[model samples]
Target chain A: MSVTGPAGFRAAGVAAGLKASGAPDVALVVNDGPSHAAAAVFTANRVQAAPVLWSRQVVSDGRVDAVVLNCGGANACTGPGGFQDTHATAEHVAGLLGVSATDVAVCSTGLIGERLPMGELLAGASAAATALDAEGGPDAATAIMTTDTVSKQSLVEGDGWSVGGMAKGAGMLAPGLATMLVVLTTDAEVGPEELDSALRGATRVTFDRVDSDGCMSTNDTVLLLASGASGARPDPVAFDDVVRAVCADLAGQLLDDAEGASKTIEVEVVHAATEDDAVEAARAVTRSNLFKCAVHGEDPNWGRVLAAVGTTGAAFAPQDLAVAINGVWVCRDGGVGEDRAEVDMSGRAVTVTVDLGAGTEHATVWTNDLTADYVHENSAYST
Target chain B: MSVTGPAGFRAAGVAAGLKASGAPDVALVVNDGPSHAAAAVFTANRVQAAPVLWSRQVVSDGRVDAVVLNCGGANACTGPGGFQDTHATAEHVAGLLGVSATDVAVCSTGLIGERLPMGELLAGASAAATALDAEGGPDAATAIMTTDTVSKQSLVEGDGWSVGGMAKGAGMLAPGLATMLVVLTTDAEVGPEELDSALRGATRVTFDRVDSDGCMSTNDTVLLLASGASGARPDPVAFDDVVRAVCADLAGQLLDDAEGASKTIEVEVVHAATEDDAVEAARAVTRSNLFKCAVHGEDPNWGRVLAAVGTTGAAFAPQDLAVAINGVWVCRDGGVGEDRAEVDMSGRAVTVTVDLGAGTEHATVWTNDLTADYVHENSAYST
Candidate 1:
C-alpha cells in the first residue's frame, strides 16, 4: 500500500509550521540503497516550482539519496530566492545524511507563487530524518496532500522484486503526468536507463492519460528510486508492467479523489484512425464544460458529446460516429438511437464510449464531472 | 438595432412551434437591393451543422438575396435528412423572394443531434415572410435567441451609410465565431471582395476573441450584406474601422448576456513579442477554470494567472511576467506585488491585464466567470 512496501526505502512525515492548519506538511523518503539508481519526470509547465527545478538537475544524473516533500506552500514563482531556499533545504538534508547536496531531490505542493517558510520546513526536515521508519509510508503520503480527502498509495508485487508509489493531487489535474507530486520506489536490480524507459512507458499509458480538470500544475514531479536491496534482477518487461500497474492504481485514486468531483468518468474512444486520434477525441470530450455538466446532472445528453467531438479533427465522419453512455447507445450513426431515458446514472462511476468507426486504434481517458461543488470549492477559497 | 437599420433591408420574426416553450424561433432578413454582395464566415469546426454546410455553398459565389435563421433546434449531427431540411428551407425562401435557391443563406441553433420541426418551421417561415417590415429588426433579434438573456445588436454610422447587426448566443460560445448566429447589413456601396476582407478583419478582433465557456459551436455563422442603397463608397479603411467598431459592440453585448454568467471578464495582454503571442497568452489565462472560479469568488488569485502564463511558450521569462487585476498590480515580476485586497471586484465587469515584457504588441480577450448558475442552467436541462 505504500512506497515502503519495497525493500530499500525509509520514509517519515512531520508536522511543519509551513501549513496554517498545523497539520503534517513535510515528508521525507530516503533510499538507503545498496544501489542509488534513480529516474524522474517533472511538470511540463514552464512556470515550475523552485524545488522542481532543483530536482530536475538532481535526477539528470540518474542518482539520488533522499527526497524532501512539503505541502501548504508551493515554492513556485518566488524568483531567485526560492531556488536558493530549495538549495539550502537540500544542503541541510545532505548535511545530516552525509551525502552531496545535489543528490537530494526537493518537492513542494500547496499554494503556488509563494515562498516556503524555510526555517520551519528545515526544522521539520531534521525531525523527519530521526523519524524515518519502514512503516512511515502512510504518514508520508498524508503530508503531501493539499485538497485531497485521502492519501493515495499503491504497491505492486512482482515475481522477485516489488514496486510501490504514492501520489498527491486533488485538482489542476491534466496530463503531462497527472499534475501532482509522486514518489516511487522499487527494490529491483535495474540500471537508471532501464528505470527511465520503464517509468516513461508506464506513465505514458497511465498517469499521462488522467485529465481530471484540464489544468496543469506548476510542481508536478514523479521520481523512481531503485535501491536493488532485493538483489533480484526482475525481467525488464515484467518490471515495467508492475510499474505501470502501480501508476494506474495511483492515477485512478487521483481521479476518484479529484477536488469536489462526485462521479468518475471514463471516456473511451474506439476505432479511431490512430491512438493519437483516439486520445485527441477523448480529451476534447473530457474538456467540454457543457458535457461535463450534463454528466453531472445524470442527463444522457449525447448532443453535448457530439458537439465536443465535432471540435476535434480526428479522422472520422460525423455520420459514422456513435456514443454510448453507461452502456446505453444514446446516439448511433451520429443521430439519436436508444431512448435516453433508459440510461441510469445513479452510480459514482460512469463510462462514455464513442465509436469513431474510422480505424482500429483506441484509447481511454479518465475525468470527473463539472459540479456546482467544483465551482464552489474552487471559488469559495484559495488553495 | 438590427439588420433592417440599413435602408435596403426588410426583416421579420415569427413564433414557431419548434421551441417547446412556444417562443419566437424564426427570423428572416431580405436584401431588397440594387446589389446583392455578401460575405459570410462559418464555424471552423469540421463537424459543421447542416445549415452551415448549406450556407457555406451559397456564399461562395459572393451573392446572397436573403438569410433565414431559426433558434429552436440545431440541425447538427442529424445526418443526410438534416442537409435536406436546410436545403428545403433555402429553396422555400428562394421561391418567396424571387431569387435562386443558391442565393439564400440558412442558419440554425439550439439543441444538437435533433431534427428541426420542418413542418412547423416552414409554416413559421411563410408567416415571417408576410410579417416582413422595415421596423421588424427588434423582433427579428428577439426571435434568434436560445439561452441568451438579452438580444445583442450594434449600429455604426458612416458618412452616408450605416451598418446594423444582431447576434444570438449564450452558451457553447468559443472562438471560431462564438457559436453565434448573426446577420449584418449595410447600405454602403461595396463589392463582395471588400466586404469579405472587412468582415474577416472585424471578426478576427471581435468574435474570434470572445471565448466564453470555451466550447466552439458546430453551427456558428455570421453574414454581412451590402445593398448599395446609400450609394456611398466610403474609404476602405474607414469601412473597416466602422465594421470593427460594430463587431466590438456586439461582442461586448454577447459577453454581457452570456448564459448564467455573473461577470464579464476582459483579459488584456500587453508588451508581448507579437500580437499572436499576446492572443495566445490571454487565451491561456481565460481558459484556466481555476482562475475563472477565482474571479467568480473575487479572490484576486493572481497566482493562477502566472500558472496559466507559464504554460504558454510566449516569449517572456517567468520572472519578467506581471499581472494586474482591476488596475491593481497583484503580481509584479512574477512575485507577489501590490496588495490583492486593494482591488475591488464587486462590479459585474472585471479586467485582468498581463504584461509580458517582451515587446509592444498586445491583444485583449473577453470571457465570463464560471458560476453555480451556469452549472445549474446547463445541467438542469439540455439546450
Candidate 2:
C-alpha cells in the first residue's frame, strides 16, 4: 500500500515517454477529501528546480488536491522557460482532475540543468490522471523510481484510521531531506494546522537524518495530504507517532537502496553534552570518505571514525571518546581497545557507536558506505 | 635541493627500520644557526597528532634549531603514551644536536592511532644526526614519502638568498594545511615575527586551498627555519612572494600526486561579493563528489558544477551564474551554453570557472578526481 492505502485517496503511475527506457516516468496522487489539509517540505538547497519553486507556493495555503511527480528532468537552471513549463504542467494536471491549478503540487527529479519535455509531461499527466484508482498506489510508486532498484512504500493502521506514504531516492541523497520525492497520505479528521505540525515533527527526525551520499538535490519534495474520511480524529501526539513511523520506514528503505551502496551504516552518538552535539558528531562521521570506504571494505577502522568525530565542534575530550564497531569496543578513551580482528563486518548492516563521555543526550544518523560502484554509477549518470 | 640547499643547515634521511618496508623513514634537518629564527603551522584539525602537539610547542618560542620527521607512524589517538613518544623523539634529537629539547620541532606521518617504536625511532634519530650533511636535502625529502609516488621539492633563488623546501602528501589531503609534512629553510636574515607572518600568509593561499578529498589530517605540519648565514634580508614584501610561490609549488605537487587521482581539478569562483564567499563557493565545488567523478570520466558535465555551486550560501543569483569548463562556456546565465562536446578534457588538468556576477572577489581551490583507485587506496589504508 502506497499513498492510496489511506482512505479517500487515489494514485497512478504511467509511461510518459520521458524516460528513454520506456519505463513509467509519471505519477499522480489525489485526495477526494472531506478535509483538503496538507503540508509539504522541499529541498533546502539554494539551487532549486522549477517544480520545487511552483510547489512551494502550492503548499503555502495548506491545501493540496493532487500532486504530479515525474522522473525525467530536473528542470533546473533552465531560466524562465523551466518555470513556465512547470506552471503549464500544473495547470494541465489541474484541468484534467477538475481542481484549481493553484492547488496542484509538482515535483520533478533527474538530471539537473535540463528542461523537461513539456509536451510529453502534459500528456503523461493526463494519462496518469486517467489511470488513477484506489489501488494504483504501487504503480505510482514504480513510476517515481530513477536509479532506485526498488520502490518504497509504508503504511500504518490506527483505530479506524490509517497513514501511508511512498518515496523514491537513489542518489544525490543527503540530510536536509535526501534527494527524495515523497507523498504521505492520511485518512483522519485532522485540520491543516495539525497535519502541518505532525509532518514537520515527523520529517525532522526521519528524513532529516538520512545521509546517503552527502549530496543535496535541487528537487527533493515531501508532501502530506489529509483526507478526513475515517472520522477518527487522533490526538496530536498519537498522529505524530504514526507519521514519524511511516517516515522512518520510508527513510530506511531509501538508505537500503541507496545507489551503489554496499552497506547501510547507522552512526549512533551517545553521551553528548546536547542532542545537537550528538547530531553534529554523527553527521561528521557519515560524511567521512575514509570511514565510508572502510565500511565498504568490511574493516573495523574505528580510527577513521574517531578522526571524523574529532573534526566536529561537538563538546568532547579526545581522551574521553570511545568508539564501538558492530558490537566490539574497538577504541576506548581515544586509544586502541579491543582487537579489530574480533569485530565482524560480514553483514550488510553496520552500527558504529561513539560515546562522548560528556553527558546523556544522543542521536543516530543513517548513511551508506562508499564503494567503487558509487564512483561508477555516479560517473555514468553525472549529466 | 630541499631544506639543506640553504646556507647554515644540514639534513639527513636514514632507515630507522621503523617502516615495515625497511625504507628510509627517519629524516633530520638541523639549522646550524647564526640566527635561529623559525615559524611553523600545524593541522587545524581539533584531533591533532602527537608530533603536532609537540612541534607546535617547539615553535611557540620562535626558535628552532632542528626538526625530526618520521614516516612510519602518525602516533595519533594513542593517548598519553603517544604524546610521550613524540616528546621522547624530540628530546632524543635535541640531545644529539646539543640543543634544548624545546627547540627541536617534530613531524610524523603514516597510520594514526598507533604508537611509535621508541627504541627504533631513537636509534634512527641518532643515525640521521650522524648522517646529516649540507647536501642531504634530497635524501630528507625521500624519507618523508608515505604513499606518495614521488618526493616533492621546490627551490627559489632571490636577490642574494634562496628558499628551499620539501613536502609529502598523497591522501587525507585537504586545506587547513592539507595532509602533508613540510620543511622549509631560508638563508635570508629575517626575524621570527617576519617569518611567522610570511609563513601564515603563504600557507593560507597555497596549502590551505588544496582540498584533495575534504579530509583534514591530524598530522599536517609546515615548518620554516631561517638562518642569517647569507647576510641577505630582502624586502618583506619580496620575501613573502617567494615563500608563497614555494608553498604554491609544494601544494600543487600535493594535489598532482593526490592518492590515485586521475585528474587535478582547479575550481575558481569569481565575482563573489566577498573573498570569504568566493573561497566558500570554490571549496564547495571542490568537495562535490559528483563533480569530481565527472572530471574523472572526462565529461564536461557543467550541470554538476551548477548543482555543486548552488549548495553554497555565497552571494549569487541562480540565473546569473555562469560555468566554464576548460575555458569553454558550457553553462552561461545558468542556462545550457556552448556545446559540452566542445570542451576537451583529454588531459589530466581540469579547470572549472564559475562567475557569480555578484562582485569582483574570487578564490581558487585545487582538488582531485574521485576515481576507483582512490577508493581502493583509501580503503586499503583506512585501517
Quick one: best DockQ, which candidate? 1
| lDDT score of residue A142 within candidate 2 | 98
**CA-based DockQ, model 1:** 0.69
Error of 2 at B257 (Å): 0.3
Where is model 1 chain B poorest over a 10-residue stretch in terms of lDDT?
Answer: B374-383
Backbone clashes in candidate 2 total 0
Q: lDDT score of model 1?
A: 0.91
Task: Please provide, for model 1 over B1-383, each residue's C-alpha lDDT reduced to its tens digit, 9 standing for 90 to 100.
Answer: 67888889999988988878888999999998898999998898877889999999999999999999998889988889999999999999888878899999999998888899899989998999999999889999999988888888888899999999999998777889767998999999999999999999999999999999988889999999999999889899999999989888988899998878999999999999999999999999888888999999998998888888878889998889899999999899888888888999999999999999999999999999998899898887662
lDDT per residue (tens digit) for residues A1-383 in model 2: 88999999999999989999999999999999988899988888887889999999998998999999999888888889999999999899999989999999999888877789888999999999999999999999999999999999999987789999999998777877867999999998888888888988988889999988888888889999999989889988989999999999999999999989989999999999999999999999998888898898898988788878878899998889899999899999889899888999989999999999999999999999998998998887854
Question: Please, what is the whole-model Cα lDDT of each candidate in the order they appear?
Answer: 0.91, 0.90
Estimate, for each residue in B1-383, the C-alpha lDDT of model 2 and write its tens digit: 78988899999999989888889999999999899999999888888888898889889999999999999888888998899988888888888989999999889988777788899999999999999999999999999999998999999988998899999998888778756999999999999999999999999989999999988888899999999889998899999999999999999988889998999999999899999999998998888888888898898888778777778889998889899999999899888888888999989899999999999999998999999998898877845
TM-score on alpha carbons, each prediction? 0.98, 0.98
Clashes of each: 0, 0
